[model samples]
Target: MRQQLRRQAGAHSDHLQDVLAVQERELKRRFEAAHEDRLRAERHKFQAELAVVMGELKGVRDAITARADLDRAAHHAQEMWVACQGLKQAIRTGQLGAASWQQQLKPLRDEVAAIRQVAGEANRFVESVLTSLPEEVLERGVYTEDALRERFCKVERLCKRVNMIDDEGGSLFKYALSYLQSLLVVDAFERLPGKEQRDESISPKLNTYEIIARARYCVDKDDLLQAVRYMSLLQGEPRLVASDWVRDTRLMLEARQAADALLAHAAATGLQAL
Candidate 1:
């Protein structure tokens, strides 16, 4: 009986020892898992920090690039202005030699191209001041065919020198020239007494019908000033004055003095003739 009791006590002691060993092993596994989880969290935090640093660096790089571009544009604009001035001075002095013409002209060409790229109101003003219109041409009014042609040539030369053909002012100047030419032609015909005396006129083939037709053509082309001038010359003919085109053109020139003056003169002349 004593031996049996001792054996039973030893078995119970062995079972308790096994249970303690299993619990210890479970605790060790949990500790190792916790350590791994902490390492992963730390790695994730390091990646996020790296991304923020890269974003800041990229922003700095972009800002530097933008500033560099601005500086370059300013420098180019300054260089172009200086070159244009030199060319203008050379032209005035007549130092543009045939052999060195291209060399001397290079600067102006470069400047014009640069200015065109940066063409704003300020740049346009600078160009106009640099290539100022000729005093002699502006002073004289172009009346005759020869004078008009000569004036046009002078204006065209100025436009080419200044690279101004595409500008608003340039377009207006060209239109003015056309208007003047049409005015001169109509004036020549009006000076003649009648169709029978057409032989005395320069444009002998242009009768009253042709004159009125030309005026209508000018109106169609949106050359109102020229159209008005021609219509003013046609005021001698009552039928033309009553025409639909004439009425429309008169409406267009409703508040203008030029149109009123022509109508007044024609009425006075007709009264005198009667």
Candidate 2:
């Protein structure tokens, strides 16, 4: 009976140890699962915060880029304005040469190729100014009021002898007459009323007399732009005769316009920057 009681006690002890071991394993598994869940939550929170920070940084980068672009455009605009002023001064003083004038405009052609749309338009205008105008005209053909009157006097004297002809040129007869007329370069004589019946204004029709008279009127007013407009209506020999005048007029007008365009665009850019 003593031996049987020892065996029962030993078996009970073994079963109790096995039950404790099972309970410890189950508790460890549950604790490990809870710890894993906490770690996952922390990782997700960190990722969310990182994403928000990255988004903010990206926005800052974009704003900085835009600000930089605006500043660059403004700089180019300022350069263009200065160059245009130089051109206008050259037009007035006739002191600046084509080399210096074109040097001032070089930036627009080479460096500011990627400038804004408005600046690009200004560049195009400047380029046109260069082509439409001759460098020689910048030094010469600076018209004053007195010069206008004297020039118109000569022009009027010539237009007075004009008559309509269907020929492309002033006709072969008129050409011969021109040679003969050149010999009569004696405007020093007193004029009669019949000789004074010159073209005072453009008449009802579009003819050589009207064109020359109207063009002269505009030229007399020192309005080269208007003068060129009327003069452009000429064809054949008249167009050829007035070609130099037209070119000079185009230069003056184009220079002013180019300067105005660049300055205006620059002013607008400065306003936006402010």
Candidate 3:
């Protein structure tokens, strides 16, 4: 009986040891899984922090770059102004003359053009700067609004002089007149605050007047081609129709069109040449 009791106790001890071993294995697996999940969470947190830092760094870099660009642009503007002053002084001292000044004009014009390109606003800022300059400073060979006007007058006088000398100054006169007219147009457009203010400014009316003047000049020169071009420019503006010059020019153009159509029909029908 004692042996039977010892055997039963040994069996129970072995079964209890087996059960404890299975529980220990399961607890170790659960601990390892929890540790792995904690490590993954820590990695994700670090990656998120890194992404935020990179974004901030990029923003700071962009701001620094933009500031640098602005500084460079400002420096270029100052240099252009200095160059302009030097050129004006040279012209004043008789270093440049009408015979050779046009060649020298290219460099200064390029400098102004460079400013427009770099500033990204085109001619707006440059024209505004020119407008702010004194008339006397502008008159001394600078291409300001007043200066260009003066130049145009001089060119007109030169044309008359050449005509008196029995020389053909038609091309030169037309070129100078066209340049001044274009400058006036650009100046007027720049004067407006926005695209919507185009009609509000006196620019359109001024443009019509300029076109009419060009047409009259063309008529005086007997330049039918240029007159037609000037007339076409006024055709877009219906408001100028009340002007006698506009009315006359339109009538002339209509008469020319009718004549052209008749000539075309005559040629198509093999009629004799006029």
Candidate 4:
């Protein structure tokens, strides 16, 4: 009986040990699964944060590109405006030159009229561009100093070409006078108090003889040395004092005295002879 009891107790102890082993294995498996789930959650969170960061970077890049495009457009519009203004000024100067020559030569009027027509077309084109440009561009003062200077240089070159052509066509004096007159007109017109008055009245009347004479008088008074220089260029190596005499110091003196005498005679008798 005693031996049987001892055997039963040992068997019970062995069964309890086996049950504890099984419980330990199940606990280890559950802990491993929880650790894996936590690691997976952390990885998913990292990927989501990276995606958000990339999206923000893309937005910033797009904004930068948009700003750059706006700047370029504004710059282009300002350049166009400056070019148009310069072209208008050149056309006005050309018209003045033509008018001055017309008083002395009829054919010059036709040339000037053609230039005026072309200028009108250019003006219309510029006006269209101005109208089409965004108001923001003008408000921002998009024209750079370099752009303005370049346009001015281009217009000046055109004026120079016109002057050269006029000189070649046998009207150097008239063209020079026209150039001086145009400068004065532009200055005065720009200095006017009101934009409307300048644009409507002063700007359009820049091609008149009175205007030329006024400009010449102003220039002469301002710089006598420059006036003398210009006059010397115009006279260009005096060749003859009169129909009868070749040019010399003595002949020049005699010619001056004769001119004074003729002026006096004309004043006295209101008569002149060629």
Candidate 5:
């Protein structure tokens, strides 16, 4: 009878052990599933945030990509500025992540690094274009392209003031001829290329009004060299008035060219060639 009791107790013990083992396995499985679910949620969030950040980064990329033409750089400055702002926001968002969160984002390490590198390159390019100059490339410093344009306008206005008080003094007969010439300038005296549009009513040579208009048109067309050429044709006070402006415009052009080379290099090298 005692032997029978011992066997029964042993059998019951084994059964209990088996049940406990099965329960432990079930508990482990549940815990694992919970952990995986949590991880998946976190991954989804990271992916969403990463997508937004990448979109912002791509905006900057697109603008730079569209900047293949050097003259178009000035045109796209505002676009670049806006994209850079978006990138700045994205970087700040990334930096706001906690240390523990950063570890959780380990899978995104490469992507985050890539964003940082591109952002760094973009910032350098934008600063170089908007405020700084490649003195090594251009051998000179310059104002921002926008500032150069503003300066030119102010200088043009100052030069035009010379016309408002024009005093071409000469003999009475010469003055009479000049008055007749003035009358001939009922409209601006334009010596445009292609063919002569001259008539009795139009002056054969460019008047001050025509010179200013032509130079302005050249500038509008991003033809700084031609603008300078037009301005150089001025005589007397207008020439003196425009001399400094012309010099600065030339400098701006050189600096702009240097910036263009830098931009092209950056583009050619996948925008990583800062």
Candidate 6:
């Protein structure tokens, strides 16, 4: 009985040792699985954070590009505005005359048109860029330089035409002297007989009046110099043949010279060149 009892106690001890070994293995497996799960959770958290940061970075880059484009467009518009203002000032000052004003129209029109086109393009670009944003944010006024230049050019051309006509009329008076000279050379008084000249002196007087009439006609219809030349001929006739001839000649010469001087000054100034 004593031997059997000892054997049973040894068996029970072996069984308990086996059960403890199995429990130890199961505990180790559970611990390893828990650690792997924790590692996977940490990796997933890091990946999610990295994706969010990349999205934020892309948004920042896009905003920067949009803002840069807007700045460049605005700068160009400002430059165009300045150019238009300068053109306007030049027109107002009369520094640009009719011919010059007309000539400038082509370039001014082109520039203004180009500016408008560019502004339109820029507006479209801004609109597209801000399509997601509100319209009020991109609102701006449009400028039309071409219209203003057109009006200025028309006025300048009209002024130049008027000036041209005035210059032509003023210069015509210079021809009167030439007319008088021609009359003197022709000796128009010889048209009457010698006896008639001695009688009432009507021949000389008639000759003078004829020359004056001819000169007046030439000056009115043809040229001033032609008239003046004829007038001078009548005035310069031999003093022995006519009375009061010297006085009349001096007066006509003086008047012709004054007109010539006025015309010369106008020509030199380029006012009559147009």
- Using TM-score as the measure, which candidate wins? 2
Q: List the residue pairs that clash in candidate 1.
A: none
How large an RMSD does model 6 have? 24.7
Q: What is the lDDT of residue 145 in candidate 2?
A: 33
**Stretches of model 6 off by over 4 angstroms after superposition:** 1-28, 48-63, 79-108, 120-274
Candidate 6 residues 45-106, lDDT tens each? 99999999999999999989887776665565454444444433432332234354223322
lDDT of 3 by residue, 43-127 (tens): 9999999999999999999989887876665565555445444434433333244454333222233433443454345546444
Error of 3 at 52 (Å): 2.6
- Rank the models by TM-score, top first: 2, 5, 3, 1, 6, 4
| lDDT winner between candidates 1 and 5 | 5
Candidate 4 lDDT tens digits, 1-274: 8899899989989888888888888898899999999999999999999999999999999989887876655554444334343433332232333433222111122322332343345445323433443332223212222232233334333332233232235477765765665555554533323222212222323333222233234232443222222222221111111111111112223322332432343233222111
Reference-based TM-score, model 5: 0.34
Against the hidden reference, what TM-scores do the models get?
Answer: 0.31, 0.57, 0.33, 0.28, 0.34, 0.29
Off by more than 4 A, model 4: 1-32, 95-274
The deviation in Å at residue 159 for candidate 1 is 24
Q: Write the per-residue lDDT of candidate 1 for residues 12-83, one digit (tens) a residue.
A: 888888899998899999988998899889999999999999999999999898777766665654554444
Error of 4 at 67 (Å): 2.3
Better of 1 and 2 by TM-score: 2
Total backbone collisions, model 3? 0
- Residue 205 C-alpha lDDT in model 5: 75
Please state the error at residue 61 of candidate 5 in Å. 34
Q: Model 1 residue 192 lDDT?
A: 32
Could you tell me which 10 consecutive residues in candidate 3 have the lowest summed lDDT?
159-168
Cα distance off (Å), candidate 4, residue 151: 30
Please, what are the lDDT tens digits per residue for candidate 5 over residues 1-274? 9999999999999999999999999999999999999999999999999999999999988877865554455434434434444333332232333353222111222332343344455556544553443232222233334444556786666655554333453466654554465455534443455432221133327767677667776666666677777787777666777887787666556544543544454454443322
Question: What is the C-alpha local distance difference test score of each model?
Answer: 0.44, 0.56, 0.45, 0.39, 0.56, 0.42
